[model samples]
Target: MFSPRACEGDTNPVLIPFLLAAAAAAAAPPAAMRLDYFHTGDAREERFALDAVVREGPWPGPPDRRLDDTGLGRYQFEVRDAKSGEPLYSRGFASIYGEWETTPEARDRARGFQESVRFPEPEALVTVTIKKRDARGVFQPAWSVTVDPAGPAVDRRPPPAIKVWAVMKNGEPADKVDLLLLGDGYTVAEMDKWHRDAKRLADTLFAVSPFREHRARFNVWAADTPSEESGVSRPSDGVYRRTALGTTYDAFGSERY
Candidate 1:
């Protein structure tokens, strides 16, 4: 017999609040956005000159590298509240490619000395607060960074010291040309090796006739330490991260070197 049968079901009811919550969460706006800096290449300067001289045993480094029009890149961010925009806390870091230059011995020597390493102020910080308002608008965080005026915190860690020398084509004073010498931290033995390497680097420059002929006219110096206690690095989760070094670069690349 093909008779229709009645189905039995539970009497418990579903909660309306739970279903609404699920819908709200699914419709909420995205929280993160990305910015690129590759288009800004004219801001950096040529800080190194191979044709400079090394008169003094070691030379002092420049105050800091300045940012120019080509230094920065596109940026974007989202903020929840302007009133609560203050930073809960902040920190930074710096580093030199130990592999960028210097021989193994010098790299070892540079590990010993601890000194001040200067960096551009205003690396980046929260400035403007982007939020959802009465009008249709995108939320973006305004930010800025600066070098601390207090100076480098003396490193108590037993690390190496690094030395840098610049040799120009014509013997000229160090102040005559713009230069920037960067370093990574090291051990005591590494400091000694770095000093020796500094001399070696100078000698290598002189080996070239153009620099050799102008050797007497050039100047030489060393940075007592790395750029800062934290060492140089871009802001975390920042738009300027890739743009600051390689992307927005104004000068000094494989083609130039």
Candidate 2:
């Protein structure tokens, strides 16, 4: 359960259900696993190679909702039992690589993007499959790899040390939507401002229609590593600065991103 100080004095009776859910989640939840890979391709050819399998922190999603039924995104990945071929988990997601592949630059040359997919740590050996949507919008296998949770090849290094705090806490993470706010270019001196901005953004998000009505069903978290400088680089303006997260302006020729 989150500390009482996390949410301050904005208590409402509506928060009780979410709080109860949080308590249950804390009792027993699976560890999170991440598959990091290089997605290399162009307009005509594509390839995927495994980089590392890492144990992330605790699984924050509901244990019951292991399979994603939503048919969204340009790509999907599935984890299946090695012997039975039974799917244990799946998710649909979009990636920067998926979008970049459609650009004219992809036709001119090959490129690669670092990507990661996260899921609950499985109990046994599993085969992971990556699928992409065809021209007719059907998903076809792009890559597949086998994973052993206890394999010597799996990387178990601890995640980077950074401060994290809850902006809003409703209940156990498994029972609620968890939103992570990642600050891109804030400097060490501006971390306080970043925290305030995260809270303000959460407030703004919950002030909208659907979110406002069901605000109790969500948790907001914020984490950031300070950049040496205070702003992102804008190559169009001939200005550059090293940032902690390496985000830059004019990605894909879009100045505002």
Model 2, range 1-257, lDDT digits (tens) per residue?
Answer: 65667557766455778888899977778889999999998989899999999998888888788899999989999999998999999999998988888888988999999999999999889999999999899999999999999999888898889998889998988889889998878998999999999999999989999999999989999997799998888988998988998888888777657
Q: What is the lDDT of candidate 1?
A: 0.32
- Cα deviation at 192, candidate 1, in Å, is 1.0
Q: What are the runs in model 1 whose C-alpha is more than 4 Å off?
A: 1-181, 226-257
lDDT of predicted model 2: 0.90
Evaluated at residue 143, the lDDT of candidate 1 is: 32
Model 1 C-alpha lDDT per residue in residues 50-125, reported as the tens digit of each score: 1111111222222231212231222222222224454322212121221222334443332221112222222223
Q: TM-scores of the models, in the given order?
A: 0.25, 0.86
